[model samples]
Target: MNNEEKYKKNIHHIHDKSYKDLYSKREVALDLFKNISNANWSKDLKAEDLTLVNNTYITADYEEREADIVYKANINNSEVVFYILLEFQSSVDYTMPLRLLFYMCEIIKEYAVNAKHKKYDKNVKIPAIVPIVLYNGEQVWDVPNQFRKMIYNEELFGNNILNFEYDIFDISNDEKLNKDALIDLKNVTAAIFLLDQKMDAIEFLERIKVIALYFNSLSDAEIKAIKKWIKNTVVDPLAESAIKILEADKREVELMVARNAFILDEMRENAKKEGREEGIEEGRKEGRKEGRKEGIEKSKLEVVRNSINNGLNDDIICKIANVSLDLVKKIRQECEKN
Candidate 1:
């Protein structure tokens, strides 16, 4: 890839890495799962029972797809795969269900291969996969959650058609994510979600102050992780002006909050000044146009008056002065009265 493409890819990779690093923490992962709406199955499960599993899968087309997070957990005496798809795109993926299906099938195929199960082996027990998509996009996710919804004439096939519904956690949407419970639980993942939702740098910086309150409750390692994520995903992408103010005092979250209060007010004043300058520039352009138009009208009236004084006939004056015959007549009548 060229430098620009490589830069974009690296930026996207940074986002993926930051998210992977945060969720890989057992505490954060467990907290996310427990907060999933109608997820009573995970209520009885503990941290020890949840094992991180391989996420890279090769599809039938020989294309490799790496899932964000995958966990193996025994729920109700059955081995189940919890495939958490961390989606950070700004727009909704229309083929979300199909993407989930492809990943799930690959997971099952890998499971069968590892277990040494024959093609038609009835003795081999396939692990049930609970595919969950965690989206932090700006737009509301409008994609179909069920695989059957993507298939044509699915209703006609009835039970014969393969179908499964994936759970979606729109982290930006409070209705989808139990924000109150997660906040009450002091989950770091909730803080990440809340920060990710604020696209504006000022709003993001403001939210960091609220998130800082949880630092005392978190471990040093967790605090470090949050800082790293912010630097890589949030702060680095900001404009140089904002970055200067934010980086004024060692870039510490607590220190920055205190310094930024004054900085924010100054930034708002600068924005107002810029707006006023733009309005003045626009008004100057309008004024110039009006002046030019008025000058042309005055010149036209002068030509009509001169033609009248030259004793030129109406039709000749109309052609020479480029004024209408009616205007020539009006000028001549005015001269007679004077």
Candidate 2:
């Protein structure tokens, strides 16, 4: 499709990979459940208590499906599995409860096979599973958490119908679990949650600065992983040139944050300077010879072009340059050709 369409798809993929990578860390996973989950038992959990369950199993349809973040933990002397499904769609998925049910079934099937359990055996006892959906979408999540809600005449069926509810943490829309709550936890996952939210460049850089303070408790490897996640998820997709600026730093997390801030500030200044100079020249030609409207249009075009060259996306360019979406797309096409 078009660049915009590709960018949107790429963003979803990047978000998936980035979150999976982050939660791959035992400490990050531990922090996520501890800080985010409403379950009171999570407060006493430790990194050593959680074990990552890595398995690739075939679905009922014979398609290979790789499990994302499944963790096995013991709580109150009982085995429990936490299956975390990371969702980053811009809109809500109506079939989320059904999807989670299918995934949970797969997980349980795998567990049953591994445990050598027989159906309806006298000595068989299945471990409890706590399915959780972590959604970071912009839209409000209005979907029912209970699987029975998807079934018609569920109230009539009552106890006869199989009903189970998954815990959902709608990070963006949930008022009780917003960025402020995450920041209060002072963990790497909290910083990640904040950075993942939608914000402008200046605010994002400021957030990077605030996020650096939370890294003091992280190990060297954890710090490295967080930096790489930030680069891959945020910088590479939006401001490509910022990666070069970040690469110039060989110090610690604070220095990396400083470099990111510096990069955005420098890019902003350069865009302003280039837009002004180009606007003046264009205005000299168009304003005197033609009209004031032509000069203004030329000025906005210069800003849009400069923004695009600096690796800013169309949305940001449109806002900063005070130009129409059509104008920005047209200028982007012209720039790509040259």
Candidate 3:
């Protein structure tokens, strides 16, 4: 697979693993549910009250889709199920509301089928479903939260239109949950999402050290899974070098010091190389007396375009091309139009 696809796959894998690892435990799941849902009933519920449902609703047609998580629990003295859908794509999906609506319908249909097999009374109440979308993409989620919002000109239909709103936990924004209040695996998962958005190698490594403090409390298997995730999703060369240093040591604090030093050295080397290249390019441009300015501008634009095509971030492209951020953004916008 290409780098972009591999990156996305690794991210999804990490997310799936981390989520299941934490949510499978009743205590952690209860805390997470209470924090995210803010339901009055969750305040009095214990871990023993929750039960995981292993039913798979994904059909052959939807085989390409990731399996969503479901949990059956008793809340407020009533039976209910929670459907957790994860969206980690770089861009927002406008059809998410419709997709969730379809999934909820399938879940209810399955419940009905099972109820029939049990010979349930016609007056029996159906279990309520609470759907949640956990999104961690860099872009803001601007899609409609309610199914009715997806319908065109819903105002005309007024109260006749069907509607249900799903809860969203957007990790990109800090307004959702207080990360400091979370414990153990939940805190580490939040740190992972927060660190993923940081582009600086030093800052990322420093944050990783904070996450490592909780590693000693986790099982060996969990540690291995998290380490594997770091190796896969963190593709920055400087960050990779720091990870290598950190992995060599056992003590978290010592490893943090070692990683910081390694990152500094790597950053310096990269900066020196960039400077040398810039100097060489400048020398070459100066040699061409005719159309020198135009040639330089054309070369810079070409470099920006190539970097964008190669999936480089704006900061890196700006530094490499020795151009302003606005120029890089303009070129990216123009490229997108084409």
TM-score of candidate 1 against the unseen true structure: 0.67
lDDT of each: 0.60, 0.66, 0.60
Among all windows of ten consecutive residues in candidate 1, which has the lowest summed lDDT? 235-244
lDDT string, candidate 2, 42-77, tens digits: 877888877777753325652312225677787555
Q: Order of all candidates by TM-score, from best down to worst?
A: 2, 1, 3
Q: Please give the lDDT score at residue 234 for candidate 3.
A: 52
**Candidate 1 local lDDT, 1-338, one digit each (tens):** 65445644555566666777777776667767785444766687776767777565535552322336677776555555444444334346787777777777877877778889777876757776777776765578888888998989888898888899877777676464544554565556666676666333445556566556553476656666666666666532232323443334434656666565456445444544554555555557777556455545555566556545533335444654566756776776688679
List ranges where model 1 is wrong by over 4 Å. Answer: 1-10, 58-67, 74-90, 118-123, 178-182, 214-216, 237-258, 274-338
Candidate 2 stretches with Cα past 4 Å from truth are: 1-4, 56-67, 75-91, 236-298, 313-319, 322-338
Question: Would you list the clashing residue pairs of candidate 1?
Answer: none
Q: List the residue pairs that clash in candidate 3.
A: none
Among the numbered candidates, top TM-score falls to 2
TM-score of each: 0.67, 0.75, 0.65
Cα displacement (Å) at residue 202, model 1: 2.7
